[model samples]
Structures are given as structure tokens and as C-alpha cells.
Target: MTRGERALLISVDAGSSVPPYEQLRGQLAEMIGDGRLPVGTRLPTVRQLAADLNLAANTVARAYRELESAGLLQTRGRHGTFVAPGRDDAMDRLHRVATDYAAEARRLGVPPAAALALVRAALDATRPG
Candidate 1:
């Protein structure tokens, strides 16, 4: 299902002790952790989601801000918000390896395009026959 559709599955219970923003944050986080909302999934705009859930824009905005601070979401200018890549140890290790490669490329004065092409070739070489 689409990210927005998955987000729409979240509901707030006004009568419950928990606040709406926290409820929204928790549900979205749970979905992301459980793979229902995978990495790179684009979330709805704050106003759109607020309208969808009958919430104030600030409510959804707060949730988005909190998630972004926690590294669970990333906002790309004009591209909207997306689920940040996983924070699990394996993903962390991969990120570290990629960072090291990028650093080495920078030290060697390799352009980004050339560095990316080298990585792509390595990936292609490792693929199963």
C-alpha cells in the first residue's frame, strides 16, 4: 500500500490520555519499524495529513519535526518528506562504509559521478551470474 494510505490507517482517540500528535508519531514510527512504511516512502504534506486526520496543521507538523530530529524522516526541499533509511546496525555499517568510500574519493579528488560509477561497477560485478 502507498505511504499515505498506510499513514491514514493511524487514528487518534480523543478520549485517551495520550495526545494526538504523540499518537500519530507512535503509529507512524511503528509502521516504519515494522516495514509497513519502508525507507524512501514519501509522507503526505503536513496540511494534507492534517486535513485527512481532522487535526491542526501544527499537530502533524510537530510529529514530523520530532521524527526528523530522531532521524526517522528527512525533508528534501520541494521534494517533500521521506522515511529515512533504516537505523539498524546493518544499515549503520553500510552507511559507515559508504561514508568512508566518499571520504577516500574526496581525498583522491574523484568527482561524484566517477565515484558513483565505480561503486556501480563493483555492485554489478558482485551480482550472481
Candidate 2:
């Protein structure tokens, strides 16, 4: 296993109510979001990862697809998968913070409008005149 794969330490909880794909997806997403998996880091191939984790290839693929849709991972044919690069550093940080905020709001059972209003109010308060 490479340094990146070892650092990944991803696992699927077979006994959990959550599906394996979701568990895998959540872990990988959190790692990418927190920079534990730095941008452009190469990911293990679906087959390889599946073998290592004792999961079906489809499960790993599904997780990868979901993460890709969420802008966390990108796949290049033959070359394999990698953590998606930030198009712009500042925007990337903002996007990560925004994603974190949205997740926390949802976890707290806050209404979407309320969460958005809070963000707007924060931006307004912080904006220079």
C-alpha cells in the first residue's frame, strides 16, 4: 500500500445501518474536505480498493461516483482516480467551508432558509464598507 492509501484508512462498517457505499463515501468525502487527502492525491483503483476492503467492486465504484459528483474525486481512464484539484485556492477554501456549514446546519436540523440567511448575515457583517 502506498502512503496515500495507508493514510486513507477507509473502512466499511458491515453491521451499521448505513449502506457500505454511503459509509465509504462519507469517510472519503470527509478526508478530502479536511485535506487529509490532499488535492491531486492518487486513489487506489476500484478493484484494488475493493479487494483491500473486502467489498464488491460496485460498492467502491458507487462511492467513487458519488464523491466525484460532489466534486471530491476525479477519474482518468487508465491513469486511475485522484482527489479533485481546487480550481482556485480561495474559492476552494470558501467552497469547503460552505460545504461544512451546510452539513452542520442540516445535522442541527436547521431549515435551509435559516441557514442561508445566517450565511448572508455573516457575509454582510464581515464585508468592508
- Which 10 residues in a row give candidate 1 its minimum summed lDDT? 1-10
* Number of the top TM-score candidate: 2
Q: For residue 111, what is the lDDT in candidate 1?
A: 77
Task: Work out the TM-score per prediction.
Answer: 0.63, 0.67
Off by over 4 Å in 2: 1-6, 87-129
Where is model 2 poorest over a 10-residue stretch in terms of lDDT?
1-10
lDDT of 1 by residue, 1-129 (tens): 353434458798887555899779877776666667778888998998998899999999999999898787899978788889757867546645765686688679887689899999999999999
lDDT of 2 at 105: 80
Off by over 4 Å in 1: 1-7, 90-129
